[model samples]
Target: MSVQRGGLGRVTHIIGEGLEGRIANRHLALFGLGFVGLFFVLPILLLIPESLNLGSTTPFESYRRVANGIYVDAFVRSFLYGFVTTVVTLALAYMLSYFLAFSTERVRTAMILIIVPLWIAYIVRYFGILLFLSPAGPLADLTGFETDLLFTTPAVIIGLANVYLPFAVLPIYNSLNAIDEELVNASRVLGAGKWRTITKVIFPLSLPGLVAAGLIVFILAAGSFLGPAVLGGPNQTMIANVIAQAFLDNFNIQFASALAIVYTVLLVGLLLVFNTLFDLQEVLGNI
Candidate 1:
């Protein structure tokens, strides 16, 4: 009986040791997740009470103000910018990604070149665009034609498209790369021409990446402050710029917090809508 009890105790100890080892292996990942959650949650917690108008007994007053005409226009303009930027970025990125995925032998080199622009600071890139468009800048110097291009809606769109182009490219390229080569061959064997193969086979398979890229670019562009602030004129200011002005220039934290909360909720709602309409989980997984 003593021998039997001793054997059971040994088995229990071994099982406990294995569980500890398994947990140890996952500790780093758990810690990383916790750290990121804390980082994101702390700011949100700080903002929530302010957004609710803490200590003022006027909950949602700021939100009511945000829904007024002026702010409503800003929201509409922001969405417009997001949509236009998404369309332009998608057009440029799809072609580049397709080339990189299917036509290129130097895929690594081409990808590196495409990503090189991102290494420069975002502000610097915008400034470069500003300079290039300026009357005295290189474009004028080369063409001997001066034009005023700064502080316009077109300038803002150009800046956004340039800045977010790589983001769209990478996901689309990933989707295109994931397509089976055999599928393309099979399509060709079925008497499909080059254009038809691309339209039917490649494009359908790449929709996940395209959708993911569109969502990402639209979100970023819609929430953008710097691009609009620097490249846009008075009328081109976005919701993000308005939000910043509420906090910084006007020193209205409550209003700013309300705007932030509203904007965040709207974006989250949009994402939820998209997820319901499309298989966003599968799209994200493919990415």
Candidate 2:
């Protein structure tokens, strides 16, 4: 009886502790969460039946089809390209945003330039890149060097990074711009040099934005359809391409369903690992 009472006390204590200023406006997020829940997540859940053949002796058949060597390679290629694109996009966006935040007076003009591309359709922007990278395009006209960059891995990554640059920049700039000027002045007064001040104070304060940008870019890049379709070759095909092929061209609903399920699972697993490593809630809480 004492052990039962002790356990019950512990459970109550845990719940009480959790309720004490621990949940940061989580209720407000329910609308956006509801959209994912009702639209994206629910639809994905509904695909489970289509992904299996329960009437047959082998219900796991579609999943088995996904284990093929080519399909495996596509999954690996998709994630690898996603990671590389996120890194490159973040680096470029951070530098650009830092300049916009601190270095430049023409922030309005620069922001206009950065934002203008987002107004353009993705296919149009990708097609423009296609022209620029092609052997017959402006690059070849100037350099007189016809290159195979148009239909390769590097081209695809470049396209993904460029396409997603604005997403990263906006979030990071908001974070950077929100920082108090007094804090920066205080750091300088405390004998922290320019680089030291930026690295130690500015960057840490900006992490919430950086983390938000990373998640947005990573998800978009991983599931990209147009970038790889326009810029990559057969060797560079990603999972999205295969899913498109299965669903659109081949009309293989079961195969497409299986691919979608696997991709969703893998993406969620990766995000979970990322959250664990970064302690994202803690990082954002500081903001």
Candidate 3:
């Protein structure tokens, strides 16, 4: 009886050790997850404390100093310009990507050649456009058209659209390429005209990619400062420019942090909406 009892005791100890090991492993994993959460949450957490107090010399004082209307207006203006840029860029990118997806080998090669300009440096692209639009530039010399577009809203829009065109195109192209050719052929065989097939079938199938491209361009355009600062005037000041002014011009660190947080939140909200509507991973992976 003693020998049997001793054997049971040993078995119980072994089981207890196994349970402890499992618990330790779970605790380690939880700790790692907590650390990761802290990594992202720390900055936002810091802002909240500052914004709430408003007395601190941090960037949060902007919430108190600036009127809600002005902040909202800045956001609205940024959204308006971003929306226009995204819409135009998406439409053009979709057309170009679709063409690349369906065109003959020679046409594909030609389209790639056209896309090569997108791979160049952004500053170079900006200057290249400037050279053509400036008073002494090619467009003025050829068409006799001239304007102070070198520092205007139109210039900012043009610069953003050009810079972000590739970001829009690459995703649409990948999504279009993944589509089964047989599906398109089947539509054509079933008495669908080219336009009808494109509108009803191709466009719907590529919606995910379109949304991805629009979101990318919108976010990029909204957060842009360099283009607007260099090419735009007071009328086209974006949210990013506002943040810069708060920090650099006014030396208002607390207000700048508040604006920065607001800007980040807006971008995050947009991204969440896009992810909810379309599979971001699928579209981004393709791009």
Find the candidate with the highest TM-score and give its number.
1
Better of 1 and 2 by lDDT: 2
Q: Would you estimate the TM-scores of all the predictions?
A: 0.88, 0.86, 0.75
lDDT of 3 by residue, 1-287 (tens): 35555788889988987887467677878888888778867867786555454455653346655557767777777888898888878888888888888875575675677679877877787778878778999989888888788777788888888888888988787778878999899999999999999998888888777877787899888888777777677888888888889889988677777777777887899778868877778756654
Compose the digit string of candidate 1's lDDT tens values, residues 101-196. Answer: 999899999999889999999899999998998888999999999877788889899999999999999999999999999999999999999999
Backbone clashes per model, in order? 0, 0, 5
Which digits, one per residue and each the tens of the lDDT, describe model 2 over residues 57-93? 9999999999999999999999999999999999999
What TM-score should be assigned to candidate 1?
A: 0.88
Clashes of 2: 0
lDDT of each: 0.91, 0.94, 0.79
List where candidate 3 sits over 4 angstroms from the true fold.
1-45, 49-60, 68-70, 106-119, 271-287
Worst 10 residues of 2 by lDDT: 1-10
Model 2 off-target regions past 4 Å?
Answer: 1-38, 285-287
